[model samples]
Target: MSIFKSRVNTNSDTYNKNHADSLAAIETLRSLEQRAVTTSNKRRPVFEKRGQIPPHERLSRLLDPGLPFLQLHSLANYLVEDDNPETSIPGANLICGIGFIKGVRCMIWVDDSGIRAGSMTKTTMPTIISLQEIARRQKLPLVHLVESAGADLTTFLVESWAGSGGMFKNLARLSAAGIPTMVVLHGPSTAGGAYMPGMSDYVIGVKENGLAALAGAALVKAATGEVADERQLGGTEMHSTTSGLVEYLAEDDTHGLEIARDIVGRLNWNTRAKPPKRRPFDPPLYDPDELIGVVPKDYKASFDTREVIARLVDGSDFEEFKPRYGAATVCVQTSVMGYPCAMIGNNGPIDPQGATKAAQFFQLCDSANLPIIFLHNTTGYMVGTEYEQAGMIKHGAKMIQAVSNIRVPKISLYISASYGAGNYGMCGYAYEPDFLFSWPNSTSQVMGGEQASKTMGQIITAAAERRGEPVDQELIMREEKRIYDYFTKQESAFYTSGRVLDHGVIDPRDSRNVIGFALETCLEGRNRDLQPNAFGVSRM
Candidate 1:
């Protein structure tokens, strides 16, 4: 019963500043998400005219009311197009999240046809792949509200054409792994996109709007001199009867969603096995609202990682692992909500001792079958002559090895700075964490802007001296400034989130709920049994 005592001074000037900065960051994230939703909502008129429900509305109808829907990559592809941020739309023309379908947890992807006719862009493909990956890993049933125009041919690239095959391959894998995939086709799904419904275990198509075809009328006419109508080639009627691609036909979008829900309900997904007994737990001793003040406004300013743990863990009761040795890397055994978990939080750079401690902690968590949550806020492993001599690389490699090989689920939350190997050690997205999220004030990069600029400046100055040439001080300053600005801008939470580096940026207040949901989702995967087959079920 080791309950942590709070050291956070909420009324302090520093705390107030930190809270204000965090609030501003959260507002920025909220505004961006609102812009994406507004972009979709603006198309309501068009969808109404077509007698089809808007993508978001369809999703709302599909999901169980009052249940939490964890949307992923809401601001994806923001400012990734041209340098003009004003014209750029976030969400990559797709709305995706995990939510309950008839009380059964499932992954849902909706084609935002309102934007670019629901076309797949360079930014959107990764989100699609990620959604599929989550479904496969979690064994969650997948439901898609399809109405995409497929890949945008105007900006088509060879790499995109080559990579498109993996989407269908994942569908096959999902079915083979005994995970159900249900698709509700509200509009066109042409070219390679037709395989979406083609590979699903259950497909519900709308009467007039649902169209799935290898080639549309225009393409058909261009390939051969034969003129054809789109509906005749691959309409819902054609697929439901002649082509046998559709399993169910509905009158409209609402009806299609109903059929999709009913299909998931009929899967008997929850009946496979009973979940483990729930544990009784106490809420955090500190207010979650205090989380905003825990993180400093200045990225370099130090804050106690335990302050964060105090507000997230049950009753602020954490059994610290190795309190004296390797104190920089803090490891604690605590429960998030009611679920037991091992958490690794960074108070500073990882020294040789810290790396070894983390590696050992990871193994212990793995052996106990408890999930690990990483609270990332480090510049990276310690450097300089002393650390190098102490086997920093060897110890760091051991930590990476432990993270890579651990069988239990890993969840990561970026609270502040995550730079260099610190990101890897803290389970950055590269390690394929079961779920990774970041606070809007967080930053991820190879190194800090000041450190990078200084290092580069020193290198340039040394190079000039070795070549018997005088270094231009102004030129060096300009180079350093450019490097600093670029890295600084790129490392911001918005930039990384737009690139789909993490799942999404979340408010500090929602940390507990988000982590709890992730734990429950991961636990379901651990408990559920899947019936695997040599090959997937194919359309006959």
Candidate 2:
């Protein structure tokens, strides 16, 4: 009976030990599962949700399908304050990467205004810096889609006090590097948030939806005692006309996006992978006799020079760039006799303050490897205190710089009214145009007839006052006419005497043949991209 009791106790002890071990193993698994659930809820990856795809998917759908996206700073993430948690909004507000549009790759950043007004915090800086580094290394295009209230107030103190650098330096570096950056102003982007767009290569504003500035209207009113609405503060029409800050105004967001694509298509670096194919065009011949009818005998009489350009270039070939920006000058890309050529001409009626856009157009031509043909008829750089205030000196210098750097052929045709800086700026011999030709009545001088009349009128009036006698009107008129005739006749000889100033004077009837032959010879062995290299690398 004793031996049977011991055996039963041993069996029970063994059973109890095995049961406890099984319970512990089950509890450990349950603990791991609970921890996993907690982490899954806290850290949400950017995968698609149950009912919706993300903004990136929508963007891809909007652009070309089957295009691959190369994400920049994909691992770096945004930080959300506890007060502005995900429950209060959609999530941490940032969508950033480098992607392709129609197979052309670019860096893109989209702000989510749905969450925390798309404010920039310390956390967002890392992503921007990463994108900047990539842009510098690869020389890819950068595009910023802005929709922000401003920087986050919660993190502003930390940023100002801590060891942190702003994004302005990086943006300026990229711009100077010629990386071809673009900004899309979609919604309100105020203060530091808008500065990135302002500093970009091209700033695009969507009509009513876009707004950008250093401060909001309310803040501006408080700071400077100025009362204005949001549009007056930072609107497309206001900046496009008044400030000259924004470039390429769009009707809406969709249009703004499309403009971004077109601007990229027009850039030199953006299409470095392949050369642009030349399309066929037929430019009408401009008879030398026709030139006589175009310019009136009087210098003051104005005629539409744009019509002359249209008649000379190929059918509807003129694609005017920055037309509204520079009214005093016209810069257009078109084909003359089915060959690509850039035409720069003088157009009157530009605001005396805004003449420097002409120089910007010249710089763009140089960068794009396009040759120039100057049609000379400019009064001079627009004169006024407003022009001085607008930094016209600095801007006008850029034209001289660009013309000097031009390696391709440039031809100058002096029609009328080429004087002062205008004469030098419009591919004059000082700036070294490859060929300088002129019409029969071409006048290249420092000033014009009316200017001579005014100076002589002042002199006559002053002499009469000194003698205590009445002014002699007939004498003044005769003196003015003599001065005008002397200068006009002398200036016309710039092309005739074979001086350093003139290449040759050509008849209007032979104008077409002259240009056609000149272009054919000048354009030979051009386009450095097609040349053979021992190492098979492009040098241009």
Q: Give candidate 1's TM-score.
A: 0.99
lDDT of 2 by residue, 1-540 (tens): 001011112135443553344334334323433332343233224212322223343355435566544332221221123322122221124555556664555667776554455675444565565556555544557778777766666557754424224466777766666566778776677876666666776888877767888888888988998887998888876776778767878886677778877777676543344423355765454333344455543445575566556556666357777777766687788876667778888754333333466666666777777778888777777667987687667666666566667776787887656777777778786775655666545567777756867788899999999999999999988898988776665564222222224544444445555554445434542321221223211112
Q: Of the candidates shown, which would achieve the greatest TM-score relative to the real structure? A: 1
Hey, what RMSD does candidate 2 come out at? 32.9
Off by over 4 Å in 2: 1-279, 285-291, 349-354, 459-481, 493-500, 525-540
RMSD of each: 1.0, 32.9
lDDT of every predicted structure (CA atoms): 0.91, 0.59
Cα error, candidate 2, residue 23 (Å): 99
After TM-score superposition, what is the CA distance of residue 507 in candidate 2 from its true location, in Å?
Answer: 2.3
lDDT of 2 at 480: 89
TM-score for each model: 0.99, 0.42
Candidate 1 local lDDT, 444-526, one digit each (tens):
99999999898889989999999999998998899899999988889988888888888888999999999999999998987
The number of the candidate with the highest lDDT is 1
